[model samples]
Target: MAAVIDLNEDVHTLLPLTEHRPIGTLPFAGRYRLIDFPLSAITAADIHSVGLFMPESERSVQDHIRSGAAWNLDLIQGGVFLFPYVATRDYQNDDLRARYYENYTQFLRGSGSKYTVVMGAKNVANVNLNAILNYHKAGDNRITTVYKKLPLDRIRPTDWTLALSEQGTASAIVQAKERHDDQGKNEIPSFMDIYLLATTDLIDLLDDAAQSHVFRRLPELLRDYVLANNANAFEYTGYLARIDSIQRYYDSNLQMLDDASFQSLLLSSVPILTKSKNEVPSFFAKDATVVNSLLGTGTYIEGTVQDSVVFRNVVIHHDALVDHAVVMQGSKISTGSTVKYAILDKGVVIGPNLTIVGKPDKPIVLRKNQTVFRESEVEGSAHA
Candidate 1:
């Protein structure tokens, strides 16, 4: 079994949502969180031991991944370990690098595994690390990176790039600049932020990084190491949806409506594991109209829902309409209100006769536990 290192990127893009929890604990797909896929992938690889190094508040993450039983990480021998931020230093400083070095070395030294798989968990993809490990074991490279070749137009500016050599070795790591001014023929290979390496070798790299004062994240540091030394690249051809912004998250959820996309992810050989919830069946009223939407259990739907994802224990009152939106758990859509092209966080309440609307491109997000009041009619003479 390989020792796994799940590191936080210190990415602050997913604001309001991530205000209270780490990126891994952010909710997704109505029933699962962002961390579920990565944990599932880790378990699928049969790697029982993992060290999740969090860079921010980890209470929510801990709560979600409690005992790690769902992913078979509750073994007595080697199980999930939480390594929260312990060093007082800037994320991009030498102290931070040394901090990672300390934790990583400590973890790997006692893991009883020879190989390590390091990755970021925020991205959405059904990665088969078993294949990646096979690729690594078959090659003589010190590090093997997993990357996906996406079209330039489909690629986002924030995505990282990996330029591979003719021998499939990584030659360069490129950070995507601003969007292309011309739509000319320029395709880029986006790095999947996943790597497989020998644990001892990873320790050696950490020591080297500490000595050299390498402050960048592991991916950037690994890029430099790969350039100087021989490292392989594992090309991944699969569905990849990275949820960074609200728009992307909303879009990704909506994209699940497609059979191919939905089937490719959730229907993988290794099922996505999430914390179990004890909830009863959803109740839909006779007048409730739902189309092309996902409804979680214990929900009472008395309104019209279309192209949306509704979570557990939610109440959609009569005469309410939800369209092109995402509603979280314990939220209530009061009667005679319309929520369109918006996202309501957990425990949000839409008051009666309110119409909350947002543009298709920029969806309005109501914070958790918020209550939108009904719009009042202005008493005035008409056509004065």
Candidate 2:
């Protein structure tokens, strides 16, 4: 089977962090990118042929997945193919639909595989695609979609929830907004935007979409197909974080600090892979104190860090304090500065003697390449 990774996610809520990079390339867990989860799942299933559909500006995605060597998708036959949309001011829903249909149809037709697995990059989960594939093969259904039971708050307004029949197949696809009466339910089956279907069936669905002039995203179209055909629903009881907003993103990263969550997601039998980086070991001063934090290589720490994830090459000065924060690569906390409940993007420098703090629910965000010298300057920072 071949695979398709869609990178066109709604990233407006993750601005500044996603302003320059696609959602797929966003740094996660102090090391892996969001795309690594799906790509690693595909690789673990021994699927070498893959296609990535990206938006107009995809330099970050290209830079990270260059030659697809890390995922073993650089083979001469049935290797990785990137289909990026050309930047245009006149782009509309119809144009996007036509473009997707054309590229998706061509990719599936050329993959030379009977089955195709399509997934998006926003939902963070370490799925065992091989097991799902085996289950799909054993069943007689033409389509299978994955879902996880989640709380009401975790379900986004745009997300699709399933109404399963007695046979465990999806009888209807319900939008989160339309389920206001079901708020009392403890948990709802939320779709993961992952689908597996025969190549010919997928092609037929795309052709029907083109003929019907339906302008919808690929995931939405797949949802409609599932409901119409009574697709089989596979329950995924793993740790899932649907990152459609800034609060979810922040919470998801910090959730990794928990031993159980980290072990279940990262230390599982199936490894999550990414582009390798070689750096020197991180240094810590004699008086430095770090507790319950994950630090990347090439870091120099001299301050008190608690409950945080610090990326590579970050520097925390002698008297600074980082509490419950996510510090990206190349960020520096000056000697007298204190950052608490915040996210510092790459190359951010907090000037001396400044204290920037935010509430636990709403973390302050410093965009990429920002240098803040005073408290007033931080007031202008983005707050999730």
Candidate 3:
């Protein structure tokens, strides 16, 4: 089976962290990027051919997946193909659906596989696509969609939830906002945005969409198709952390600090793979006191770090304190500074003796390459 990865998800809520990169390339868990989870799942299933469609800049994505060597998708026979949307004056006024359909149809036609797997990057989970493929092959359904039962509060309004029939098929697809608790169910079958279907059926859907002038994204289009066609629903009983908002992102990262959650997501049978980086080991000074934190390589820590995730090449200078924060690569917390419940983007330099703190529910976000010398500079920078 071949795979199609959509990277066109909205990132406005994840801005500052997503300013210089796509959501797929955003740093996570000290080392891995968000793209690594889906790509790793695809690789684990031994699916070699993948078509990644991106709507914005490809520089960061290209750099991270360079040749797709990490995912073993660099083969000459069947490899990863990147389809970046190019905006030209000829199609300036036209909706992106035209370009999307053209590129998608081309990729699907060239895949030469009987089945196709469609997925997105925002839903963070280590899914075993092989199991889903086997399940789909056993059934006679045209499409098999994956869903995870989640609490209503965890399901965002933009996310889709499925109403399953007695036969374990999707009878209806409802948005999280429109969901009604007629049966008094606290948890709903939240769509994981992963689908497996016959390549021919996918092509037919695309053709009909083109003919009807529909402009929905691939995932949304597939959602409607699933409900209308009564697609089979495969329940995924695994750890799933949907990264839809800043609060969710922060909570998801911090959730990794728990041993069980970390093991469940990262150390499962399906391994999460990422690009290899060669760097020196992190260093903690003699006076440094670290507790329950994940530190990346090449980091020099001389402060007190607790319950935080610090990325590569970060420096916590003498007497600084980092508590419950996510510090990206190349950021420096100067001596005597205190960072609590905040997210410092890459290349941020916090001046000495400054205190940057935020509440537990809402963390302060510092933009990329921001250098704050005085407290006044951080007054209105919180985008919580």
- Which one wins on lDDT? 3
Cα RMSD to the true fold for all candidates: 4.1, 2.3, 2.2
Q: Write the per-residue lDDT of candidate 3 for residues 145-220, one digit (tens) a residue.
A: 8999998677777677888887888876788788665367778899888899999889888877766543566776
The candidate scoring highest on TM-score is: 3
Clashes of each: 0, 0, 0
Answer with 2 or 3, whichever has the higher lDDT: 3
Question: Against the unseen true structure, what C-alpha lDDT does each candidate score?
Answer: 0.79, 0.86, 0.87
lDDT per residue (tens digit) for residues 2-74 in model 1? 5554546554776666677767776777788888988988898889789888766878878888899988899
The lDDT-based order of candidates, best leading, equals 3, 2, 1
lDDT, candidate 1, equals 0.79
Worst 10 residues of 1 by lDDT: 375-384
lDDT of 2 by residue, 157-260 (tens): 76778877778887667888776557468888998888999989998888777766546567777878877787778999878887777778889999999998
Model 2: residues with Cα > 4 Å off, grouped in runs: 86-97, 180-184, 380-384
TM-score (all chains, Cα) for each model: 0.91, 0.94, 0.95
Instruction: Please identify which of the two predictions, 1 or 3, would achieve the higher lDDT against the true structure.
Output: 3
